[model samples]
Target: MTIGSLLLGSTAALIAVSDARAVTTVAEPDPTEYAKICDVYGSGYVYISGTETCLRIGGYLSYYVGLGDVGLFYHARTSDVRTGEDQGTWQNNTRFTLKAWTGQETELGTLKTYTETRVNFGNRHTSVSDSSRSYAFNGDSILTFAWIQLGGLRVGKDWSAFDMFIGGAGDVLNQTPVPYGALDTNVVQYYFDAGNGFSAVVSLEEGSGVVGTIDNYAPQIVGGLKYTHGWGAITGVAGYDSNYESVAAKVRVDINVTNELLLFGMFGYGSNGKLNDDPMNAIDAHGRGFYKIWGGNWAFWAGAAYELNETTSLNLQLSGDQLKNYGVAANVAYALLPDFTVTAELDYDRYGGSAVGKVKASEVNWTNANKKSSVGGILRFERSF
Candidate 1:
């Protein structure tokens, strides 16, 4: 063979050998490999991620069914219809909620915000039949909770600092946790963290009582301090309500001896600060307190409160007047099974006084004395996931 042909033949053989080796070393990829990758690291409906914001979705749902009798009114004459009737009914208060939270990491710091909405499918009995009928008092869908937490400031509607005096998550029964008078308030607030589970908060809220309408824009100042530790928690609150010029104060303490045992109690007092002859004069104040214990599948709570009786004010003829206010409540609960429970509660109230103020100042009027109370019990079965 010629020299040029010999060189060309060897080059062609080398090219063929390289092509065969490359085909044998490489295998075909599986069609399902891409799907597996997506399942392990791809986005999901419950999660979102982008930029510096990480979001997580979570909330709680509760359904409550109850039957009981509650007092509605009191007759003028003690001998005539002094006590109301025992009305029996069923109720279902269910709620479902959604919450979204977003936080961004920046040079200054991490800024965060959250918003929530809830639908209170109030007791089915409150709804009319297929033929549509609207009930005004039947609670409709609501913006149950919405707030923003940035640095040390929180703005928007939220739980009042004073409301902690009533009860904590330890209470299994919902309605019996707080009295009508000692309720939560929606307001704008600012708080300072003292570290070591201690914090102080001050808030501007509406007046003390619901006079005739709902307007939270009224002027009121509330402040409180809270401290938490492995052994226990304690809180104190003080406030001023300008409508009645009311001065209010409260304190609460809770102790956890073990994982299952707990002891808690709270005391509260409020008084109208204005003089009787003053232009904005309003006289009303009261004191309330309660103690509770729970452990080993059993819970018991008892409460006693008194308010200044305003029954003897100027117009005594039309308004049944007296002086002496009293209230009491007791509750007990036991677990029947892992998922079932039984609860019983007794509540009582006696309204008296020419003016309801601090409990110590209320007077006793023998002629207009009256008593109102009720006994309620329920069995509940709950399944949690």
Candidate 2:
């Protein structure tokens, strides 16, 4: 072949090879992934990557300052000095709470799990003589709630169904002066929703305290039925104390008076009257049962909430029992920001009947002929996310 023809042939072969190489150069797929927002349960949920489950994390921080006779109203031990002496002092507390939730869809129903943890730091009064410090630094931490649910069945630590059914209405501090029922225990529970705002719950609980705790296979039984609508709801719960062989029942009604107003009332009764003389005497033979911790055979609570504006609201509560223990609590809460709130509250308590006589003669000297009432107030600020 001629030299020019050889050069042309070589160049043509090189061009053909370059074309083949270009055709074979395939691009790789992208590997970056982003989290997806989950709207199934509520806000702040996101789907976990490479999984079918959705996860949510949330928390809140709060600081509280209390004034007036807080010790008297909150049942703090007083100084063993002169009669009718005020045992009030300034108090401060800080708390942080963390919560997590996870959910997934299953053939039977939605499977879910929830957890809540809390830590508290406070300058609590250990004794009347030990009140000269500012920050005690002694704090406490607890796993307040941890539970799992599949369809309608749930198992874990939770509030008793007797108290859960007829929940506290207002945001008033110290709502349980008369004591409706005990809270916080391990439970195996099942819930049923009949649709149209009708639901029911049955729970077997490990009662609180040594004597109240289940010694045998017989656990504390709690059952409740609720009817709810756009306006409000009515709920009733009954609890059977296996150890004491007694029963207690509570009925509550909530009314939506207006778009900005709400009202609620609850009444509780116990079968055994002899057991209620001492609210915390659970170890004694005729002790108050786990379900009936009120200082009487019957108790009642009423509360109201009124929204003053979009960012402000007022709440009030009145509670009493047949033993003449009465309490009044009120609070005004204002939202300083989208997820921040400030609240101011006032509380008053009165001791009557045998409790008053005991207070008058006790070493603490909390009450006298003219001093049967105690008043206190608190200011709190909280930020939630």
The CA lDDT of each predicted structure is 0.45, 0.79
List, residue by residue over 84-128, the lDDT tens digit for candidate 1: 232345454556667766555566555566666666654332223
Predicted structure with the largest lDDT when compared to the true one: 2
Task: Compose the digit string of candidate 2's lDDT tens values, residues 1-385.
Answer: 9999999999999999999999998877444434588899988888888788999999999998887654333333333344535454567778899999999999989999999999987765563464423344648788778999999999998888888766864578777666778788899999999998999999999987776788789999999999999889999999998876878999999999999999999988887734444555533333357897665567899999999999999999998876567889899999999899999998888865333212222333334453377788888999999
Please report the candidate that would top TM-score against the real structure: 2
RMSD of each: 13.6, 6.8
lDDT of 2 at 56: 97
